[model samples]
Target: MNADTPMIDTTAMQRIGGQLGTNPAGIFQDGNGRRYYVKTLESPAHARNELIAAKLYQLAGAPTLTYINTKAPEQIATEWVELDKKCIAHLSESERKQAQQWFAVHAWTANWDAAGFNGDNQGVVNGKVLTLDVGGALAFRAQGDPKGKAFGIRVDELDVLRSDDGNPHAIKLFADMNADDIKQAIMVVVQIPDEKMRRVIIDNGGSHALAEKMIARKADMAGR
Candidate 1:
């Protein structure tokens, strides 16, 4: 990671690393010597969901992941998801480990959801963890309103990118109904760790806070 950018704290890393248990996602190194992968603790379905979301963004010429959903034995079918140069996947063991730490810290602090839609940036050029992607903000869970309960889906805008300094920026493209629900959805997206990511989403669409009562709903079996 960069000198200016924050590095994972040793104590915090030791805590989360123990929780990660195994490294199901194989390792690879990025150009900058960083490594990354979806957490092994995450189910294959969840990993595939993010990969699919990344692929959709790729199809739209947006910056996202070139994710493959298959196992090592089925590597031959690895799809060619041509995303914007900014969205290309950077798989590396070091990057993945660092990312896992970041995700764990953010989850503990944010406490929004278990995963909190966290993703890591592996585009570091030096020793710094590059901000290649904006994380946080989920599709639907609860409207911010103290009294309202609703849900929706979201898509990212094109402006989100990996900065020269390696900060992940974002632009949220929301999709769903329920005014309060949408507002809550907006909150999660805006809560993204990097201010640039929040700004990107606001610039692309807009921002708002929930006015109704907050209500949590059970996610469908399909998963959020």
Candidate 2:
């Protein structure tokens, strides 16, 4: 866990809803009375992916939810926000820049579930856009994994090399991202300590090979 990652007491949590999608997630109130969206995965690898991605986004200066690692394995609590849809035209220049930087960083992490792209996994807080879910990142399939055949699944190299499409807002935001902006985003990944990264990989059943591949992908994005 990152030194800054919050630790939540699961014993005080109160579930607020049914399962979300295939993952068992619920809206809950913590001991302090703060509400959060908690998601629990069956795979340790997936939980680790979500936590690391959230931390990377924070380092990259992107708008993201506060991610906390609960006592239970495969579970995490994210700061809650009201879901809303506001067109790009409604965003101010600063918000637009933040959104673009977020897209660049998301691309660096090979995250395909970003909101306003292919999924409704985003929410607005104080008129700024924040990513609500980042669990679908850094995925590596072993031989014979069925997800490998899924259409539109983004791999590390492909995400680094691909251009934004389908979402007009994302396309416009990315258009404003210069090479330097991309390099800064990639540098965030480079700044993460190796020991912390290794723990995340090993504890989550992820291979060192995948971690190295992701680092290389960040390098490729920086060069692009």
Candidate 3:
């Protein structure tokens, strides 16, 4: 599950949820089944950077994700621990406590020392009182993290809270990603074929629009 692993043929991955504006590569299983997503290396340098970032997060013991190497196309696969819908809805007080515990651990390793913190989130899942997005705690400010000093921490936080509010998570995660390596890890995924047929999203300095353009271009080539 390290960066050195091979890529998977994620084309066979069943799309459970609608694509989010943030992580265009976003894929999920229903609240019932295991979810999996595959990311490919569109460009060599970006892929290496992303792989390094992922590996660094892992090394830090962050609860980010397991990066499986699907070398077939230089793709990366992520884990899918599916939560029960019913469980996600009626989150027990104990669940909230656990969420707080997780938050503390996340904050510590994720360099809460450098980045600032946010309000304790009301864990709502699927429109219910579930453990939604957790670690959105921004740094003291939105200063750019171009060298990715804060990316491993922030991106790990976002991945840990994906099912909470995937769309919002996607947006926030992309913003963070842009600050780190916009042209590399974030923008490179625009090469995903068949994504262009979808409507273009406008946000985060036209990141989504750029994704749409890539998708559209692929669609055009497929037609030709």
Candidate 4:
């Protein structure tokens, strides 16, 4: 991020080494005194993929750490949500529904890295389950997973590469979602206009090819 980025404060920061990954990351405060987690990435695709995932989560209106677009492609930042260490196994009916919403959006985003309920990103904020750290989502792939299937269900089959180590509880939550609910999440993702998507992608140092691929996938899902 440049010095001119007025909203973010780079002066007051806390290193989060060994907690998030090998990336050089820390939590920084914003002008409004809210803390946000920012990772200084070396790959543009890695950064873009995570930012896209953040936008996807925001579009779904699921309980997730809010992603803020950075001026540099090597930086991915999100509003740090203060959450308890408790996992999502135990929750009330309403909270469970919110967790299910997160599951649907997670699958919709094809998150290959962060495991929603099973992994370390699992936390409870205000009795709501939220997941963070999406650097391996979107365009990233898991072993043995076929390419050209980044989004949507194809021919009644869906890949399981969305999670690194999906747990039984997480699997059950995703399976419990009716088709309609999943569709609602996808609908939210496809609602972003093509021009806006292009701008967001290009502004963040993503290639036009990536933007076109995302739009084509969105168009395919919309047509179906």
The reply for model 3, stretches above 4 Å from the true place, is 2-6, 11-21, 26-35, 39-65, 72-76, 85-90, 109-224
In candidate 4, where is summed lDDT lowest over 10 consecutive residues? 155-164
Q: For candidate 1, lDDT tens digit of each residue in 1-224? A: 11243322222222111211122323332344443332332343333323332332232233333343233321111112212222114535554333333321222112122121222233344433332322222322211211112122212111111111222221111121234533443344333334443333333232322101011111111123
Tell me the lDDT of model 4 at 204: 58
Candidate achieving the largest lDDT:
2
Candidate 2, run of 10 with poorest lDDT: 140-149
Q: Candidate 2 residues 1-224, lDDT tens each?
A: 45566777656787666655446778888667787778777666567667776665665566777776687777867776665644555566776666655665667665655544433455567777877666755552211122343322233423432354654444555556676776665565556665665565555556677566556655565465
Q: Who is ahead in TM-score, 1 or 3? A: 3
Residue 36 shift from truth in candidate 2, angstroms: 2.1
How close is every model to the real structure, measured as TM-score? 0.27, 0.68, 0.35, 0.67
Pitting candidate 2 against candidate 4, the one with the higher lDDT is: 2
Residue 183 lDDT in candidate 4? 73
Ranking by lDDT: 2, 4, 3, 1
In candidate 4, what are the lDDT values of residues 26-112, reduced to their tens digit?
777655666777777757666766666666566557656766656566677777766665455655567656665555445545564
| lDDT agreement with native, every candidate | 0.27, 0.60, 0.35, 0.58
Whole-model lDDT, candidate 1?
0.27
TM-score of 4: 0.67
Top candidate (TM-score): 2
